[model samples]
Target chain A: MELFESGACDLAIKIKTGTISSEEVTKAVLQKIEQREYDINAYITTTPELALKRAKSIDIQRIQGKDIGLLGGIPMAIKDSIITAGIRTTAGSHILENFIPPYNAHVIDKLLDAGAVIVGKTNTDEFTMGSTCETSYFKPARNPHNTGRVTGGSSGGSAAALAAHECIAALGSDTGGSIRQPASFCGITGIKPTYGRVSRYGLIAYASSLDQIGPMTKSVKDSALVLSVIAGYDNRDSTCLNEPVPDYLTEIDSGISGIKIGLPKEYFEEGLDSEVCDITMKAVEIMKSEGAEFIDISLPHTEYAIPTYYLLATAEASANLERYDGVRYGYRAENPENLYDMYCKSRSEGFGIEVKRRIMLGTYCLSAGYYDAYYRKAQKVRRLIKEDFDKAFKTVDAILTPVSPTPAFPLGSKINDPLQMYLADIYTISLNLAGLPGISVPAGKTSDNLPVGVQFMGRVLDENLLFRLAYALERNVGTSLTYEGAVV
Target chain B: MSVTRKDVDNVAALARLSFTDKEKEELIGTLNNILGYFDKLSELNTENVEPLTHILPVQNVMRDDEIKPSLDQETALKNAPKHARGHFVIPKVIE
Candidate 1:
């Protein structure tokens, strides 16, 4: 495979063995970014100088015979939503357009410690409120395969980075299919670890309860490699689970024989694009051939995931976002009559359309008159959504579903129709609501050659199962996805 | 379940945001459409279920009371849009 097509693991090995200098790899990736960035719009910011400096240091360390961590000298990109010290971390919003974080997020610390050189921060939906990169103030990230189509988001830029070969791998946050949907659209491997499995310290919160940091890579093994580095407990985040991190690199290729996978009837039913459904069905057949058993199952509350996710996520987001007052961090209004006016004007000027819509929905729901009817009721329904997974797990070890309802869609096709845009994530939202680990593995493609992905969801903290399954599914079907960026 | 223009203004005020008349009109339509989805949640009977605030079973994640170093005033004010004397500056609250 070409250097751009090589997986992060292979690149790291080559770097470690002195076969190829990390500087060489970083330079090649940077050149690719320069070549294709105008068409793809994947990165919100590029750090070519810093990446080369770090890569050169790693090369020196190797020459000195010093130990380098597993991701030694690998070039990676992070979602702009994750904070990095001294880097302008805009969560694809104008509000913090000039905000350079003073502290690195926990994941940034981990990625750096693992010897991964961050190339840049990638685009996201403003405050991660939308499913496509269209909401970004930096502009929408286009799917590399087709310039007219969107890379699924709010992790669109991370997926785009991998698809366009702008970087070897990337990190993204998934709250309601932010990571997986874009991975599906871009035909890359992405996983949303079980909620709290990875620390959220320094990760800009959209909805604290549902967000997770995971890897977006060109191959499944690299996802495992990256996950192994970033997962584990940290006292900085209370919600981070206190558990021993598993060695995913060693566990990824576990055989699939006798593994019972659930094919949720709700997922396969009407509303799924026929091409996506066919691809997912083929994925199940591949698993069956590998001796995995498929059990027909029903997650009765599947249809309610969208409503529950939006309500709970927005409610939390409304509260979480209140910290962006004009008095403190981020953009401030030019003039204010008083403190209250300052707050109003700053927020009004800062947020984008989708963000404002979500905040309004959240405020309306949490209002005294409507709290129970909207926010609290959604919480209860959320419990039932989790309960659906609890019941399904009794019959099956993991669940298989389409990562997205369709492949990448033309940009602006559903931007005006918020409801239509929301429905696009129907297949992937339920996993977040249930707080389960789900990995998107590329499968077949549409007639027009748009890539589709299949999602394998496992019980909370059962990310091991997800990695193993995704690895096998990827081996069976992940080949032939060599399309690069389109020239605009 | 339906959102009106009056509802939009009330929610926007609570959210500490404002909108132009055109934006407000658009918001009213968008709010009603999204709420129509939330209305579906009311169809299910959740009368006796416990509200799940957080997914994991964690509470009161406390640590030792030993005093620890913290972000200095300078770092705290690093991203402040308006700051003076090592503190964030805001519009006057008094008349």
Candidate 2:
């Protein structure tokens, strides 16, 4: 039986029932990575030996009548940012090209505990910066649907792997729509969990306040499974919520009957690709017929989201990225004239163009005299944006919006224009700014077959509700592209 | 909003990064263009709005002031580009 078309849940049952072996599933996924990664560039590192080892152990445990956990024998890919001990983890930067971590990230530990085998590390925008996954130091990760187009990034590789069926599922981090945007472009489902919902101890920080690690998968139910395993408190991350983790699988099927969904007029306004807009409106109608109510609401501060996000995210990124100073690890400049010379050369040489641009921008924003006008003002507007969502949530249960303005665009289109690239994140950045839970599910495809994702954002700590709504939408539109498009 | 070559050079210095004359010219243009977009925020008035440093309500995370085992020097220095005698090697300081 070809296990590549199935999801983690289905594969778990197959492994538990003796219908298939864990080694077999791992082999299939590994083969897929080997075959498709050349064209897709989805993986930065593929752990064939380790994956086989984990799989062989799970198979042995099953033969001995031992109970494996929920993710037992499921093959998965991890974004490069997550630390995996003894595995070469590069957060898609040349500086960390050969640096291997001495410890596993909290999520990696959790996934291993749940019997998930990580097959590879996916590519990402360098330092999780860029909207298109083009900034990766390794190579550009192309969209699986159309080779000429790009996978929306910083979590582009993970989303691409999921789209190409190279891995059963993968983990992605969203600072300002990294996960959701790529998931949208690749035609998969991804959840940017509430801030602090997942531990960030191992995630390479871009914007500490807004960065979150979440799951990208072929289906909403699979995302729920991956989330259940990874989401929770870890003392290592101060921001990790101490609240109890809910069994998302239990209530996901509860359906969004009588759920008052908000259609933010601002999201449907100008610049949204008409086809993308139509697909989301059609999704609303599909749910409206299924007992979901759509309400016209406004996030008045929507227009300010781009400027505000750019300022604040870059500010945080500048500070957070200061750690890469050519000191204890990573890349270093050779034969520096002085300590100062070493710091400048190592960073200037190690970082890519976009990373350098952001660091410079951030440094400029936080510099004296200009700080209050830019950084402080952006933070103030950020509050207004969050308040806007808060007020709208009072009247509606959840908000639905288009994931991106357009479908997968050609790779080079926005690369040269910084502002144009930043605008691609318009719909998704505010959720991060406000620290809310947002999920992007494949709603429909354009006439040209490019995928369009519909976003559903829930109030803080309302991931369970978000999952339920995503499940509702998924059941109606059915864009689980892993099976439908996995003709290979 | 009128960022110039001098502004880019100053920011690059603060960021501890260096670039060539050509790159600096490009940087000045890009920075100026981005600043033009950022200038849009000036249109909104935020007289009484509080700046949210963090989205989460939690502040000042506390942990017990206790000693625990830490990463050993050998493992910690494993990736150091230049190291000798359990210390990172850097260009001469305190000249």
Candidate 3:
């Protein structure tokens, strides 16, 4: 395999053993980024000079026989939402187009401490409000598998970069399938750790309760390895669990024999593309033949997940986004008459159309006289969704479902209709609403040659179980996707 | 209830945002369409269920009132649109 095409784990070992210099690997990946970035639009900023400097430093450390942390010279991409000190981290939004964070997010610090070199900041949906990267102030990231289609977003850039071999692995934040759905679309392995699994201190807030930072990689083992580096407690984010991070890399190799996987009936019903369903079922058959048990289960409240998620996410988003007035940082409107006018005009001129729409909806939901009917009710339904998963986990070790109803769709297909775009997240939204961990691993492809992925949803903090199942499925039935732009 | 143009205007103001007439018209249609989806949640009886504010069982993290290192005034105001005398400059409110 080409140096840039090697999995993160493989590249890490080679770099650590002095078999390949970190500079060489970083150069090859940067070359791939230069070659593919024009067509893919996979990054908002490419820090080539900084990446090379970090790579050379790691190389020097290896020569000096010093401890080079776990990742040791791996060129990794970061989603633009995570704040990196001195790097322009635009959450694919115009308001913060020139914003450079003053400090690194907790995960960025962890990844850097682990010797991961920062390649650049990947693109995202503006404030992560949409399912596709089309909402970005910068144009959408084209799916690497087929350049005409979208890399399902709002982590589209990270997914595309990983699939196109522009980076060894990438970090993506998930709030209602931003990471997993895009991973599925781009034919990569992405895991959204359990709520509070990773710190949110430096993340650009988008639906704070649902947002999670996780890893998007080319291999299941890499996902486990990256998650291990990024996961654990941080004093900065109060919601972060103080539990001990487990050894996912060692646990991933364990077989899936006798592991019970549940097939939720609602996921298989109408709206799912036939080819996507068939591919997911084929994965189930492979696991079944390997002695894993599949049970037919019903998460009866599944139909309510979309509404519940939209209401709560937008409500929280409205409040979370209220800080972007023309006061401190970000875009400020000119010639405002007064304080109120300044706040209104700065936000109106700075935000994109979909962002404005979400802010309005969120505001209306939480407004006086309507709170009980919308925001409060959604929270109640969210509880029911959580209870449904809690009930299912009583009998099954994990729940298996398709990551999206269909594979990568052509760009501009669902961008106009907000409702239709929201529906695309139906299969993945339930997991986030329930605050659980899930992994999207490639299953196979559709007849059109588009990639498809199946999700393994686990109980809260049970990422180890999800990793084991995803690893087995990836080994048994994973598609080896190759794109035309994958030449290193 | 379905969102109307008036509601969009009011909500936009509450959100500290403004829109053109055409954008307002478009928002009225889109907001109502999305709000219509929320009606689906009404079908489920959540009468007895308590609202889940946070998923994890975490509570307020109290700590000693000790001084800690933080961003200095200059670094904190580095990205500010307008700053002078170690403070953010905003449109005059008292005046």
lDDT of 2: 0.91
Docking class of 3: high
Model 2 earns a TM-score of 0.98
Q: Residue-wise lDDT of candidate 1 within A1-488, one digit each (tens)?
A: 56776789889999999999999999989999999999899999999999999999999999999877889999999999999999999999999999999899999999899899999999999988788899999889999878899998999999998888899999999999999999989888899999888999999989888888999998888889999999999999999989999998887777899999998899877878899988888988999988899999999998898888889888889998998887668999998888899999999899988888888888888998899998899899989999999999999999999988888999999999998888888988888888889999888778887888899999879988888888788777754234332212
Indicate the residue-level lDDT of A402 in model 2: 93
What is the TM-score of each predicted model, taking all chains together? 0.98, 0.98, 0.98
Candidate 2, which CAPRI tier?
high
- Model 2 chain A weakest lDDT span, ten residues long: A479-488
Question: Which stretches of candidate 2 lie above 4 Å from their native place?
Answer: A482-487
Q: Give the alpha carbon lDDT tens digit for every residue of A256-350 in model 2.
A: 88999999999988898989988988989888977898889999999999999999889888998888988988999888999999999999999
Angstrom error of the Cα, residue A162, model 1: value is: 0.4
Compare candidates 1 and 3 on DockQ and give the better one. 3
True contacts kept of each: 0.89, 0.88, 0.93
Q: What is the C-alpha RMSD of each candidate to the true structure, in Å?
A: 1.6, 1.2, 1.4
By summed lDDT, the worst window of 10 consecutive residues in model 2 chain B runs over B1-10
TM-score of chain A of 3: 0.98
Model 1 spans with C-alpha error above 4 angstroms: A479-488
lDDT of 2 at A411: 88
